[model samples]
Target chain A: MADLLQTPLYDFHVEKGAKLVPFAGYEMPVQYPLGVMNEHKHCRAKAGLFDVSHMGQVLLTPKSGNIEDACLALETLVPMDICALKPGRQRYAFFTNDNGGILDDLMVANRGDHLFLVVNAACKDADIAHMKNKISDTCEITVVDDRALVALQGPDAETVLSALIPAVADYKFMDVAIVDYDGMELWISRSGYTGEDGYEISVPADNASVFVSKLSENELVEPIGLGARDSLRLEGGLCLYGNDIDETTTPVEAALTWAIQKARRTGGDREGGFPGAEEVLAQFENGAPRKRAGLLPEGRAPMRAGTKLFSSENSSDEIGEITSGGFGPSVNGPVSMGYLSTEYSAEGTKVFAELRGKRLPAIVTKMPFVAANFKR
Target chain B: MKYTEEHEWLKPEGDVVIVGITQHAADALGELVFVELPEVGTEVEKGEEIVVIESVKAASDITAPLDGEITEVNQDIVDTPTLVNEDPTAAAWFFKMKLKDASEMDGLMDEDAYKALID
Candidate 1:
């Protein structure tokens, strides 16, 4: 705890009565005075501000000064169609290992001249090193340390953001732009993990507090913390890197194949080039043995992570294990996601989770327990 | 009324005592989502886990404060768990038990001692 780092908005979070907890070597707010339940609901209805500065932000500049060179260089590492990514858009991607297991899930944005990436906090250092060791010859990797990233998410996010920066009104989901605000360049991305219409803004570290303060002033915006952030993403059916998907889990098994564009698939222009391309492409052609599925417990009791799932109430054979589970405030019940045997992965299938020595009944349901509201 | 270091409160009514958590414990646990109480006829020893509580953040257990036989259980809190957060000491009373030894209450903390412990 003594060596834990603080983000740019540390003092601001303290001022707002945040319950700070250690996360990925950083002292982050687990929840504010609003608590996790209400904070989660607020993010779905109105707007909630989140401090995401703990995540890693890196820029990739091409050595040949051609953005296509950097994109082609990145293709050697990830399986995404980075070369076809437009200038003002971001795509979800992951760094796959030689075994097809995901190193970390990340966002890759083509910022015109350079590629901007945001990786998970715990894997930031390793992700940067992996890129440098692999693609440094073709592209110069620069870690952006002097910026603070924050997410403003929910139904009212557009109304709240457009008021501050009028140009944001023209942007839709996954759109990225560098806009001027009070002579400062703010990198804004119309994307978030909450399955809501929102924006992830990167402000200079020195002005981070001021920008957050301005957002907090809005009647619709309340400062949210990590607790609510986790619940919101859980309800949105989004994966938490270390929880749902990890070094041992591949994108196909995690049910994230939708993020892999057609150009990177089998028989496409850039097929079988990235790490683990053999296994990943094979899984695409023939389904993976195990697949991630959503779980809706019949009772109010949450069947949390590490809970073993059986095919039936009295069965000793384990079929799966819960990866993420908790009370979903919006759904008013326990919602969860986990890897299940391909046989039990279909929606509406009945499964049993062992909790406290009792086997609880649950149904395999479609995810996004709460429907997404992104402005497409 | 007596309190335990585990944040439970006991109000003696004749040979039976009503059990529930304190407001401080409720606040610390945040919003409650589920409660699992013991069977009414079950006999529980002191320090034995008897009840399970789940909040949005995580799940926790409530142990038997003293050796006793559960005489009754609160089904309301089991249905609507948020009652524990709204009125932990009153309406959210988890159960009532007949003590195996009434003298066990003598060693518990008083209101002031419990306040000092929480503070």
Candidate 2:
């Protein structure tokens, strides 16, 4: 096997008795001694610290010294209203390919001088190459490799974080700020992937272990692992890039139309100038052939990814395939999401997942099986 | 007690044998949320998938150790799946099966050999 890369907190994770597994070219902790279910429940009720340092962080600066030029260049790559994004605010966006499929989903923060981007670890290199080849002459892209990112999430996150930086309590959801912690510069954002009220802290790589230790010192905070992270995001109805929204899946087909703001939609001011706008906007007028929907299995057996879904009315006919599925610790049952035929995408539509040679009964239910607790 | 490379353990009691996953397997799998066992009176062959154990992260299938007919299955583990994590080799035994061939036990590994293989 190839040697896996290590994050800044690799030693800390080993010290905490975390089960390490290979993920996205890094050996990351999948769970701790407390186990995945307990860690998942802890994050929902209290605060859980996660090491997300493997994600790529980049700074996009316009060589012309005009922030508008940077936004315009970004608009050509994504379908979001980058010009409308306010300073110090972050938005979720994806890089759309020529065919309207998603190259990668990312979080874009509009800083006053430059744009801050956080991309998925597995797709970062390709995303950088694509951006550089397309817009490097207009905008200078710098990969920030000296920084490490960590997330503190859950219902008690704000309260726990407030103890360290009291001013953080004033920040609302999706707010970003550059703060100083004991002479160390910290880029803190009140946003996370866990669907909980949380903060993502980008700190210097050298200080990451110290920052994580200080946060974990709080009584309510525990070190969570990737296993619970996946379960939490699954319950929140969030899509995993490679699994749920890949290069073959468009935002509209993945039910992520909300990420595309009103300004970029039809009959709006911008009127779709981004890549793949023709095909993507047309899906708004006429719905796509298939749509991503939540699946609730009737029995305890989980319908895992790649499992084929069949229409219950006619068991022999395959309708779709499960893109992501697993046991939701918070919901206390199996929750899954997959694309189904448009006709069978309605809520309460009966379906069957073929698992181990048996057609397990399932139903199309509303997504976000567990309610999001974001502090909006 | 005999062990299989797939991490299942068997304890023979006359023609009927008790079966469960090894503690090593449970530890590697983390907290189990669900367990799907084979129906009683069903015939199973060696290396066939007999049970499925699911954790919050992923699911794994437990294969049959040798050809057998399932005599009984543990309903407790199905209701409370974490029992496998708490005591995989003893209280959390998945099922009891009537062995088809007694000589099949010679092909399994002992505790020391199994420990060496995992370590």
Predictions' DockQ, in order: 0.90, 0.83
Interface RMSD of each candidate, angstroms, one decimal:
0.7, 1.1
TM-score of chain B of 2: 0.97
User: Which 10 consecutive positions of candidate 1 chain B have the poorest summed lDDT?
Assistant: B12-21
The best candidate by TM-score is: 1
CAPRI quality band, candidate 2: high
Worst 10 residues of 2 chain A by lDDT: A310-319
**In DockQ terms, which candidate is top?**
1
lDDT of 2 at A76: 89
